[model samples]
Target: MHRIAILLSTLCCAVTLMAQPALPPVFAQTDAARMRADAITRFYLAPVRVMQSHGATRPEVLTRITNGQTELGRNGMCLLSNAEGDTASITLDYGRELHGGLRLTLGSSSRPEPSLVRIRFGESVQECMSDTRNTKPCVGYSTDDHAKRDIVVEIPRDGQMEIGNTGFRFVRIDLLRTGVTVAIKEAAAIFRYRDLPYVGSFSCSDSRLDSIWLTGAYTVQLCMQEFLWDGIKRDRLVWIGDMHPEVATINAVFGYSDVVPSSLDFACSEFPLPRWLNNIPAYSLWYLIIQHDWWMHHADRALLERHRDYITQLVDQIDLTVDSVGRFRANVFLDWPSSADKAGVRIGVQALTVWSMDAAAKLCRILGDSAREDKCRAVARRISSHIATPKKLRQAAALMVIAGCMDAGDMAERYMHGIDGFSTFYGYYMLEALAMAGRYDDAFDAISRYWGGMLDLGATTFWEDYDPAWGSNANRIDEIGDPARKNVHGDFGAYCYPGFRGSLCHGWASGPTAWLSRHVLGFEVVQPGCRTLRIRPHLGHLDWAEGSYPTPYGAVKVRHERTAGGHIKTTILAKPRGVKVITDR
Candidate 1:
């Protein structure tokens, strides 16, 4: 009887052990996160721009304002006046785009007279001078009160002011009160952004790609303020869906910065249990995916430990939404223009859930929480089993491949052959999925076709949404066969809601910077903080390519060239000591 009891006990113990999942491999802890945070804080100082008004024009003021040669500091003075008939306007150009606070020191007049002043802000030259009443996305402020002393008008903290630390390259200060002399002293914009070194660099045979890379890099830089904003002009708030791609691009370009973790924490804290992030279910999953990417690239154990409980609770919330059949029931938001059907959205959600769970499982293992990790893997398996007909939705299919729900090699060929419905936003992930599937040629072609198309349309910076059929003219309705309109107003969302609508320099659309550096130049992070590196150079159709990726310790420089005999030669110019570089053909 004792022997029989022992056998039963052993069986029970084996069953319990089998039910539990295996933990992830142990990784050594480091102070990289703290060090990065400190470095970022020290470099967070914004470059100031102080410019005086030049000559003014009636319609297009693009030619009037030039960047002042004077040094930016307090107590600077510039006189802005009208010809005595029309509204007095002075345009100030900051040279490049900036996202930060604007301070205009209004010089107090010696006379005891009250004067009203109106100030307008814009991200473009036309936007700066355009009438705010018709302009949909116009940002400006007007004040009626006049003080005897210098008065500083700021974007109020109570949200009463329309414009604050927003994105702008030009400012039009209009004197509203006629015949009132107002001396403007110290017209300065305090630029605020996470001070990150330009560690990543890229140049190739294609000058257009180089230009696109620089433009994309600038676009991403403008969006990196207190948090990862969608755009500088509009919706300057953190949306997890937009943030997923933005964060990836930031990682490749800026390396690991404190803004990323702080942004994640802010998103998680703002939206508690049961509420979807930014009211989108996929956004919530994207939060987890971003967390996984951060840990994988930076290897910040302290970050994982800091948010362990919050991560567990978030995973629990996700678990509650999954049905027995592996279908997700929540708000489904894929991308703009809404191409995906109901079934396709469900499949996309399922794939994203699987991806997030996989990430959560790794995170849980890293945190030494076997129970949640096991649960995450089991749920991911269940969801993966139900993902049928991934090809129905291009976004869904691409995401499935990215999430490891489908074989990248098999899907890459099939998906790359027909990429009919892809916007700039979703195109970012599509390129990533293509690269993962080893379809380097297709990825290159897609970038040339999609992003290149945007360039052909005279896009100085990447846009929020782009349709090839729309052609070079954004105002025309060629797809619908309607008569050409002066401007595409009355469109949905940011298309033309306000005048100067649709973010011209969107951060999420800056995927080519990350793709080119990580894939084409082949500077990938194998271990967190780049302790291990993977150098797989795929210079498709390019004679030569050179770039550098920033690491915690230093920059890793690489140069690749195709030999005359059709052999590819690669050279690592510089890299951190003790870092592993795995070269793959």
Candidate 2:
């Protein structure tokens, strides 16, 4: 009886171990790769804020302060007195939104005694002044606790000190000591980002387009920090879905930066199998697509070779999720407004799966692995065969075309015509599909209507999502109405995201910069590092447009003007020597 009981117990234990899911293979980073990543991190130092502003709570005190000029000889200074109350606050603006640490030069008074002060940082003026209860991620420092404070230093001293990093365009300094005053001789923000040189420019007859391009470029720059954060304000992590569009835009503007491969490596290394990156399955697929993009533009063979085994593991993991019916069984995330439950079975996810498989095949081919390339292509073909009908959404249909699952002409007419339920994030893929289908006229119109609509609403930088009908009201309630709030700048998210939760300056929404520069200005990379350039200028309804695209070698400048006979007069202003410039009219 004892021997029989032992046998049953051992069988039960074995069954329990088999039931547990398998973990992904661990990717070991070589010492050389680790050193390379560390070197890249060290080379990309953050920039300093060149501008500043000052404001006070009291109207009279605010008016009394002068706008400090950006003079060469003197640093900007603002004084705070305790006449109003025991605590007085001064607001500082960095001119543009940024994510970084703060440094302030505090001037000492005649009194030798030290005084305590509290400083709060915010990404917006309203956020800085708002009560702590209302803010989600509140950032403030108190001198009372030296160890717990953001910056570890003595207060009320005539010296400069550094505050910890945060996402902010505004800073509020509160004087805590009664009858004590302090003069802020100088204040500046150390802007953190991957310091890549700007190599792209776009200008046109419409000054609004020019402003929009630059604003979008700046938004991209703000998000290109340590690891391509989704945005500066909130959820500042490397989300693969958001990084897809960001990587494309970075290719056109920043050229070949190490941040791209570093971000990809971080995602794959951090998230193992059976658990998707960010717990979203579609995001993992997007990461695969981004790897293909990195190879095509930057052509970093060493990086791709280093991550080959890890990439194969990811491809196999995704393949396992597909059943006989060719549907993705894991969590499907389309966009912000999409429903996860419904998106799981939707055609969008299937299309993305096929796209990812195709991308994997391309990467395998680049790596000279013919056997793996053939296997990937067979799987992609099998999945593409199952996509008989495309989803009604523009993003799904667009991805179908881009992945070569369907004829571009057939799907373009159905998806590209209407703007209903169109979002800026998905709009990026839709615009690319329209341009790829030889529909430059339609692509140009979509750009003007969708992106130009944002400009019409007085947008200095692109928004996370925009609808033309929303019209001057930032508080417009979305579908499934939650409790309405007056003067709220963002749509509600049912406690998940409260009032004014939408990011005003999002990174992925800045697709117009890439669209205008690549499609409209007709600058494309035929080979990685732009060894071969393709300039096919499409001046649709514009009098003229000119831009310069950065390459691994140098800059390639091009200009196009519409002639009276409806012909495009193209001119190549500058190009690197030995580089082939192919102009297609």
Candidate 3:
């Protein structure tokens, strides 16, 4: 019944607004739809007015709805009253000024249901007093020297006040000595306020649900005014903490080693994982590259220059271990390499590390710090040269490079051979890395030939393993029918071990999809100041995907759509600012 009433009311308001083209009558309009329309109109129509008033001998100033023909905070206040409605709210902008201290009083000559009136700072809304249902006041929030009320009072319909109640009459506010500042749409609204040494009134009303006023502007303005330096500082802090936790006491070593500080002893070592997996310090090195990429985006020159040496030294050690043919033997045993024969060098580690080194080099150039540029160039040359060699290990290295393990490339000829690729989760790993490097063409090929073939079957998400011909065991291995060597079990499929395969439906993978839809296809709409938005369409070959993320400014929606010609068109809609639409891309 309530939903039906709301729909009918909305229809009536639409008719009313459509029939007559005039500024809305603020009071007589009782229908909620008309109220909403009025609110929207007020949002776009008003020529924002800023008022500034000051006490002649004090540091205080008055701003917002002031009398005396001077926009001063003194003697300036807004009047909100209605004779027949349940509630009344008024919206005003105090600009950048902090209203130091003030008092709000209710006049006796007003007719409303309840004698009690609610006064709320910020945006205002209206309610019907005819409905007796009401909620209790909210709990209080405490700051250093003040405990401001966080509740608003509801005005009762037909109650009387000394001030005239409209739809039919006039009302006024009397402001005493108070300090305030006002500016008109100069920037986005920052809910942040200055630290006042003294106490001040702060409150919010529930009526805002029915009225939409300065809320949009406030959110929009805040995001537009964000400082770039903050991003750089945050990424830097995360990197430093991850690299130098207090538990890892050694500073001389690039990362945690099996022994303390060096290979001398284990008493003060920073090995957090198991002893057998002791050489896994590469994980921290991987994290450093990710953080450095963010820092580079914000152009943190000093941090980039300072840390470039450390990152370079670390990469140097790993690179030196690679043989003349460009393969590093695995000393760590934990990672699955050659069916639990842990000593065999794993291709995944080298691939990931090379990618990190390439990124560090790219960042150095971006910072314009050429100190490590030559070294990076030399490494890239050596890696390329080594991959070109005909040795089997070099061929694997070449495959990793072509698959975005080192620098991103568009080579489709190299793929891990028939049986091993699917069982190892290498398909997902390669797909993600290649996508990261923007090698969409090559990535799509591998996906279509391998992973997509499995998705076409009845699989809901990705699985750990996939075999082109699982039922057919005609091909012989070692001339013996060993069940362990046969790929008949579901767990033994290639997709099983890979984290990305299967319908895992996790947040981490979803984040990557959002990035692709938002950045690659680039259909997200951007409002100048508002933080929230609707999303554009995203098209990919998989089953439907959806992601909603929160930013400092507001929320964002990313969606995808897959089409012919290997095309994907994405749409991004914003509910707030911080989710930026990269216009240049």
Candidate 4:
């Protein structure tokens, strides 16, 4: 009788608990709004313009391409008719960068013979028009790595075929062979992206800066795939160091995103201790900094706790590389620009190591690992004694400033001058170091001038690497029909990205978006979890600026304007609940 009563009691309690609503986990963890494969929504969009057409390429096909949709009583198909040994092709400009593939709905063909089709997806008109194959005549650094932009396939007499799930702004479809006419009922670029609201925003007196800001944000937006990728066009992998600026921008814009933490955790899992991230020394160190940067904004202890074992071991492993005097024992590699400069590369790595240690110390303190915390701080102190003079490399100079091995104002004057040695990857740090010196105006101009240079060339998104000199004689990627002009997409880049293999839509280059939000609006997360914020508007040359910053609680709206007397005015348009806003006028 006693056993029966106890069993009934347990059953009753279970039933009661089951009746309640679903509750979050006990630990304070950010909701990993996991996007499953089914969550991938496709937006089929038609091309805006027929960039080029050859050999019976009819313009009326654009309307009939969408099944059963015809402007007139014409046949419901894009007649891709070609002659023997000759090809008929049409290049369509979608007008922007897309992350998905092309979907071609096919109708009945004129002949029983299967028509051969060649599809080329390009980030530019130059890329789409050029042939990219090992045996092809047109060759250089143009490769289909991470994405198969160039492809050849056969179209059935009655069915459709789609090719590519890559980044592109243009699509060129060619109908190959004779005695066969292929009718493409529809040709649509399948645009896939996470359906997330952009809680963060920025606007200013300068329209150019505003365009750059939004463009940068959109660049990172497309990169938020299964993982936070370095680029959508190429190098579509979770590069830890490359994800820093991306994470910062995500925090400032999206407020909180599952992709950030999940990507970090994924990188930690993909490469354990004794293995550097992306097989680069500094990238492993970047993982440490990413943790702190995310924790400060999201404050998800549960997510941080998930990487407890990995984080501790990684930091400990990094500590072993440092000697008593602060030099790194491991191979020092920072970025492509300074890769040749062995001395500069070593200094950059040392500074990055120190910067990582500082970040690790904080992370360990949060995880209650006091022993590792002390060890990180001790190593940081030892490295601080060593000074880094990054003369020509802006990447190294910026790292040195953040690592406290160099002064910001001095570093700016010595290394960074008029877009000299400006890299899209480390550009944010240079901007941050400038902000550290309170030279917000110069930073503002740097964004306008350097990033503006890309905008001037009709770039919808930023590139993996850029040189202002490239634009001196380069034709805009969108300004098609000038074969004699210099092709920016095909002509520049070095290291991993050479010539046409260069990624035109790189997430690492989206630093200006985060820089504008952090420095111009001056929205600093002074405390972890965004419990407090410090907004000190540095309008610089701008007469006024307004923006919204995302917080865990809610989005904070702010506007700043300069008075005629030169006195700056700041007004808090809106504040989230439980978030304290402190203004530094």
- Candidate 3, residue 569: the lDDT equals 45
Predicted candidate 3, C-alpha RMSD: 23.7
Please state the error at residue 370 of candidate 1 in Å: 2.1
Candidate 1 lDDT tens digits, 1-585? 223224334643554465444334562345444433212111111122323343232222223222422333213334444545667656666655666544544444322454555565555455454444432333221111110111224321111122245555656666655554444434566555454556778888877677667667767877776677788766777888888878778777778777788777888789876678877888888888888888877888888888898888878878778877787867777776544377777787788899899989988888888989998988898888777856456788778887888888877766667446777788887888888877887888778777877666445557787656555344421111234533322232332323355565688888888889888898878887688989988888889999888777778899999999987799988988867787765
Give the runs in model 3 whose Cα sits over 4 Å from its true position: 1-269, 272-288, 293-313, 319-353, 362-370, 389-410, 413-420, 423-425, 433-555, 558-571, 575-580, 583-585
The best candidate by lDDT is: 4
| Winning candidate number (TM-score) | 4
Per-candidate TM-score against the hidden true structure: 0.76, 0.77, 0.34, 0.90
Q: Give stretches of model 4 more than 4 Å off.
A: 1-36, 63-76, 134-141
Which residue runs of candidate 1 sit more than 4 Å off their true CA positions? 1-85, 90-95, 101-114, 131-164, 180-190, 390-392, 407-420, 452-461, 469-471, 474-499
Worst 10 residues of 3 by lDDT: 194-203
Score each candidate by Cα lDDT: 0.66, 0.65, 0.30, 0.81
Ranking by TM-score: 4, 2, 1, 3
By lDDT, is 1 or 2 better? 1
Output the TM-score of candidate 3: 0.34
Q: Give the lowest summed-lDDT range of ten residues in model 1.
A: 141-150
